[model samples]
Target chain A: MKGRAEVRVMLKDTVSDPQGETLQRSLVSKGYDVSRVRAGKFLQLELTGYSREDIVARLEEICSDILSNPVIEDYEYDLEEVLE
Target chain B: MKGRAEVRVMLKDTVSDPQGETLQRSLVSKGYDVSRVRAGKFLQLELTGYSREDIVARLEEICSDILSNPVIEDYEYDLEEVLE
Candidate 1:
């Protein structure tokens, strides 16, 4: 079976985001009403697997172990079966 | 009105993504069935405006002008009404 995953890795609320803060400052100075901005990483993966259970388990491991730094980042993913 | 926007910025298909390529290589070597990976940027913005129309217009400008680069990237966003 083939699957597609959309993953998002974001900093925990306790972690400060310098890039987001800088962008917010710039936007505010430019007279935009943006109050806050948080920047993170997005990943799309295409995988081939034998079963849905296999894919789900592997994806969970990959997301936490390889894709995100668990100390400061939180990651979430949505998976769907794909025809291609 | 208060609104929240989730924006995604991704490289055009024609552009090479070295980071994604490297990650894919690493995953393959780790005995994963991953065939391809594409990495991009995710942003969550909290904005305030007088009405939905006002927020939407400003967010459109902000996304194109400040959040994403048009040269090699494409951006999309989803907006929702927020109580706070």
Candidate 2:
């Protein structure tokens, strides 16, 4: 059983993006005119066969509980089935 | 003169992804045991000042002549400079 998906975890707009800020600052220092950079996380996960609803619910639950914060983070996911 | 940027375009992976496979076969026929999904395209542009290496060399020459496609599509950009 193999499950695969791409998950994008991001801080809510209201939350500060320290990594993005640092990256932008670096670019700016290099004379890159960088202004804003919203940093977010992307992840790829593999799992076994499961109901999409169940997986999605679990994913969302994980996001709100640990992967991200309901208070300052949002997430998106893309699930793919590898039929070999 | 204002310039903003937050462009993330994808299509570089052998160039084939039908909207992440119809959104993982509509979440595996609404039961959700999706296996794989890879859809990529995100953009958020806001511009004010320029110079960040001349806007990343004209945004990599407009992502190799038109927002993306070096024969396989690989791009990542984030240039915010809205100091208004």
Which numbered prediction scores highest in lDDT against the true structure? Answer: 1
Model 2 / residue A52 / CA error / Å: 2.3
**Model 1: pairs clashing at backbone N, Cα or C within 3 Å:** none
Residues B1-84, candidate 2: write the lDDT tens digits: 356775666676677778667755655665545455556644343434346666667666554665456777777876655455
Q: How accurate locally is residue A76 in candidate 2, as Cα lDDT from 0 to 100?
A: 80
Model 1 TM: 0.96
Model 1 per-residue lDDT tens digits across residues B6-34: 99999988999999999999999999999
lDDT of 1 at A17: 100
Chain B superposition TM-score per model: 0.94, 0.40
Clashes of each: 0, 22
Local distance difference test scores for all models: 0.94, 0.61
DockQ of 2: 0.10
